[model samples]
Target: MATEGLRALLHSVRYEVLPAKASEEKVLAHVPRDVVVTVTASPVKGLEPTLDLTTRLAGHGYRVVPHVPARLLRDDAHLKEVAGRLREAGVDDVFVPAGDADPPAGDFHGALPVLRRLGELGSPFARVGVTGYPESHPIIDDDITVQAMWDKREHATYIVSNLCFDPRVLGEWLVRIRRRQVELPVHVGVAGPVQRAKLLAMATKIGVGESTRFLTRHPSWFLRFAAPGGYAPERLLTRARDALTAPSSGVAGLHLFTFNQIAETERWRRALLDRLGG
Candidate 1:
């Protein structure tokens, strides 16, 4: 089951890239152009760095999706300009996050508002993806998180779930999503094949607060951290295989949060694809 799920997911997996220095070269050199490479935004650097990388990637012929964090924009004018730049660069997709910035840089405070504003701009994105939380958010309540998805559905084309470590929680959340009648395709987020130390460092640097929260509450994960190859990305994928492949699941494929470990992640994916004969 895990192998089959891996096959289906690897067929159209998205490799999420960060906005770190030299990340663009790694992306161009190792990542295949066919795969959707999503560029993550940073609160400290703003959108300039992400936009520059996205344009460069698009020029090199990769299907790029940049994280359009709402808190980073100054106003609707900023979004309009950003959208125009993306359009000029041949970018047709975007993933919206509420962002970690305090007192959000401008009018919009969250992804929803940014989404609505995008809608007002004539739906500039061909595929607008919104974040989904399978596990409880650290600050937001469960109901609010669910409602946010519902509200954004009118504007978004699909959902990209944030990283989830527990398959049991993922299973329940998948069931819950379908029950709510939101049938948009989902790109399940999972960690890529990277060293545990690198994974934690990138998670903290990228503002994956949930990852930070999980680590804080479960100190014993440090035990795995101490071991070589501590991170097994397929663990959760294997457990949630049933839920992901079920009929009407609306699960499109996997979204590997590569954390810029493109080479390692690509090797792991190719080996699994060959083993599964995909």
Candidate 2:
């Protein structure tokens, strides 16, 4: 069931990378410039590393999107500086998550405020993405999460679903969001081919430790990633093919959580494309 739309999605996929050591090098070595590279901000290291990596990647001609977590910014001034730097570096897109920073570093406590501030700053980014959850967030209520999107609809350009293993849940989420009148296009999030050990070790550093732990707590997700070999991202994509490729699905493309396995992820994407006759 590899339709034309699926093939196109594969061909124009975006890779989400953590701003960890050697990540930049790996992306430069294995990832083609055509694929968009999104750098994640860490609660431990703050936004400096994420911005640094994003700027360098943009310098190398990669379409880069830096995660500007709300809690990481000190205030409106900090947000403006960050925006100016990215705009100067030619970055036209950004992903704003509420972030995991405890006690919040500054005035902005959630994504809505940061997004609103971005508009006050004249909406420097051409495309701004907000997070969507197909599964229940560890700390937030499901209804509140959906309402967050409704509240930020005017300030955001698109929605990027968090990593979800169940195709059923993801499909249902697409329907629910549409029902709520969230018209933003979605970039489905999928995990790349990654070893369980590597993922677990860096989970907290990348701010997905809770989600990673959820995988081990659930047998299905555990087996999917902790099997004899590694996990195949294509299986998840294929299972959710219908939801992803439907005409009114509003699916933009993919946002792959590579976890810095740059070479392996790119290889998997290319092989899948070839198999699909792309």
What TM-scores do the predictions have? 0.90, 0.92
On lDDT, the candidate that comes out on top is: 2
Error (Å) of candidate 1 at residue 249 is: 1.7
Predictions in order: lDDT: 0.83, 0.87
- Give a tens-digit lDDT track for model 1, residues 1-278: 55666687788899999887878889877888789999988776689989999999899999999998999999988999999999999999999999876678898889988888888889888999999988787788887888888888888999999877778888788888888887888998887877867766866765565455556654544555566657687666777888888866788989998878888999898887787788
Model 2: CA > 4 A from native: 204-224, 227-230
How much is 88 displaced in model 1, in angstroms?
Answer: 0.6
Question: Per-residue lDDT of 1-278 in model 2, one digit per residue for the tens?
Answer: 54788998887688999888898899999999899999988776789999999999999999999999999999888999999999999999999999877778999899998998889878899999999999888778999999999998999999999989888999999999999999999999888888777776666454465455444444454566877656777877888899999867799999998988889899988998898888
TM-score of 1: 0.90
| Collision pairs in model 2 | none
